[model samples]
Target: MAATPSASRKRILTYITDDSNRKTTFKKRKKSLVKKARELSVLCGVTVCAVVCSPFREIETEVFPDEGGVREAYARFKGMTQVEQTRRKYSQETITEERYEKVKSKALKVSTGNQEKEMTEMMYQYLSGQLMSLPAMNLVHLNDLAVVTQRHLERITEKLAALGKEGDSVLMPPPPPRAPASMDMGGGMRNDEGNGMYVNTNNRPEGPAC
Candidate 1:
């Protein structure tokens, strides 16, 4: 028993000026808008601020999941405005080009520093082999590693088979872990072991032949 779709769906547009209906629509839309705003902020993990004013009410409504999120968003917006205002003021006042350049240079340095810091952290992790730790890898990341490994395995197998006849000393390497022949890209992993969508690299075939 499933619910059926509505026969008459409401079109989204400006509500007509019927006082009673408009009030009802405003309340409904306001609630929906606030819910959507909260959901968007949560899903994207970003600060979001939505201010709503109704003609019927004296107080304005602000929608934010966190108490400080609205303040932070407002401060960021104000900072941008102040920066643009300062830039415009400096341009109009015939400030020395060197001073303006210094301001721009400082901003660029700040941006570059942040990027360099992130890159340095990643490089340190990679060099130290800390990045190989898999507790933090999501399903999508794991799946991608699996696919890359499968392709590499195929290449190695083909090369080994081709060069096996070249010399008696040319040893064949152990075969790679068996993965599903085909997998649904949308799903994680699929195989006989019912391990879901995650490719299990630990399930290496027994006995090293190479």
Candidate 2:
């Protein structure tokens, strides 16, 4: 028969005091914790970081999804908003200088036609939510946008004019004017001497009075 397991097997939560045994247990538990954290992150599509402090030495061990994962997770844990983090990233001296150089290079190559293309691209980028990192637009960009819009309007007007010339639309004449209300008593009056006058039929007698 197999040897009966000890009480420690039944109670895995209790501490093991033996120096060598404790070290072994510590290594095993640390490994288990790291593995569980990584599995959880992968299965749930989440960010996870596990930190372990050395039992004997003054050192720390950390497990993360990637090199920069720890820093990103730490920032979120500290309640930093996405905008704040982005600002912090671009506000660095080196980053700002790099961004300025890139903008200058791009500006040197831009032409009149490219201005229209850039404006269209900027509109699409905004629609796609990719303009979060872009700098605030200036007056020049606004002018480009206005030019593009005017060109589009001109094209639409030309198409409408061509369609109209093709007789694709029917023009309906204005409705006939409504007849004037009757003024004669009990009957409509007739126009005499080109003047509109009415004589009441009820008041007229059989014979004319002198």
Candidate 3:
């Protein structure tokens, strides 16, 4: 058996169930942690510390930058206000986790928006006689569409509230779609300007204006 190239390989992290393997992993990781702390202190001239304790026994297993250095750093850290201390967490793992949270939030927002847009299409299909009745359609889909519609209404309410605060007049609703002229208007789809994005279909021609 041969090891795969690092660049082309993806390593999956998992818990080591075997006691011996777990112990070995802990020792190796502890050594690596201390080395990284030392390197960072030397390269950046910063007071950095790494402490690895024995999980099996009550004892200090390893400490980087010496005991005196660790004590001084600890004392300084404790002297700071609670608020300041809370804001000073800049560890690599902490920073990575924070960035991951932000990215996750953005991805969720995009997913929600896309879902709402798709649901809006479904709503139109239901209204325009392009699909089966609600009873025949999936209940889950109907629920999703209702939720999407509610969100739309909430957004409109928020915008209206903001405008009210600004003393601005409410905007007029958009004009209704004009009936497709003379070309045998029937329940069918038609391409829009060569772009396959949206197709307008009507059930029947609009009645004469009252």
Candidate 4:
């Protein structure tokens, strides 16, 4: 289930059009805003002040904590070190942009991982004789599989080139023999009739691998 977005994560924000409603909204938002600033100041031991210009002509400009507080905060800000100034000046837009980039990167990684899994599953299905032909798959899946296969071949080629003929023995050493389940112990070959996979039992098993 998708979680409902919080008030802070509002999808769209616009000014209230109705005069009465706008006035009411302004008052409520201003109160909450001032409350938050006060809480931040008290909790974090920070010097904070808010100055709100009133939309209603009757009401004068509003300053949270008061004019003295604003002046004091301004003086402290001016006296702050460059590092302190930098820490305080990182804007909402900067924070939002960073979060967006992180989310985008994570999403891309997940998408790539899922695509690889799907293509691998398709390849295994074809090899196991579950899928008879390429025509059985959709255009998109077929294209993705082809691309994945090409890349896989390219990677293998790169590895083989790097390793040269020296590591040819290491690349695909030999398949281990499976014990005879039903047939007699002739130390012969085992053919998987279902998938057309063959296993040679003449060679001894090597060190730890499948």
Root-mean-square deviation of every model: 25.9, 20.7, 15.2, 13.6
TM-score of 2: 0.31
- TM-score of each prediction: 0.32, 0.31, 0.48, 0.52
Greater-lDDT candidate between 1 and 4: 4
1 versus 3: better lDDT goes to: 3
For candidate 4, write residues 1-210 as lDDT tens digits.
Answer: 666667458566577789999888888888899899999999999888999999689767889789999999889988989899888576879988998999999999999899988897777788899988655667887888999888877887788778775446767768866544444335666654433455676684777875
- Pick by TM-score: which candidate is best? 4
Q: Residue 137: error of model 1 in Å?
A: 69
**lDDT scores of the candidates, listed in order:** 0.66, 0.69, 0.76, 0.80
The stretch of ten residues in a row with the least summed lDDT in candidate 3 is 178-187
Ten-residue stretch with the least lDDT total in model 1: 181-190
- Candidate 3 vs 4: which has more TM-score: 4
> Which candidate's lDDT is highest?
4
Ten-residue stretch with the least lDDT total in model 4: 177-186
lDDT score, candidate 1, position 65 = 55
**For candidate 2, lDDT tens digit of each residue in 1-210?**
665677336564567789888877778888888889899998998878756768666335645555588778887767977777667464468777997899888887777668788777776687699886655768887777878867866886788787775323434455654434453334544323333455555555679767
Model 3, span 49-100: residue lDDT tens? 7777878563357987788989999998899999989887788799889989
TM-score winner between 1 and 3, please give it.
Answer: 3
Ranking by lDDT: 4, 3, 2, 1
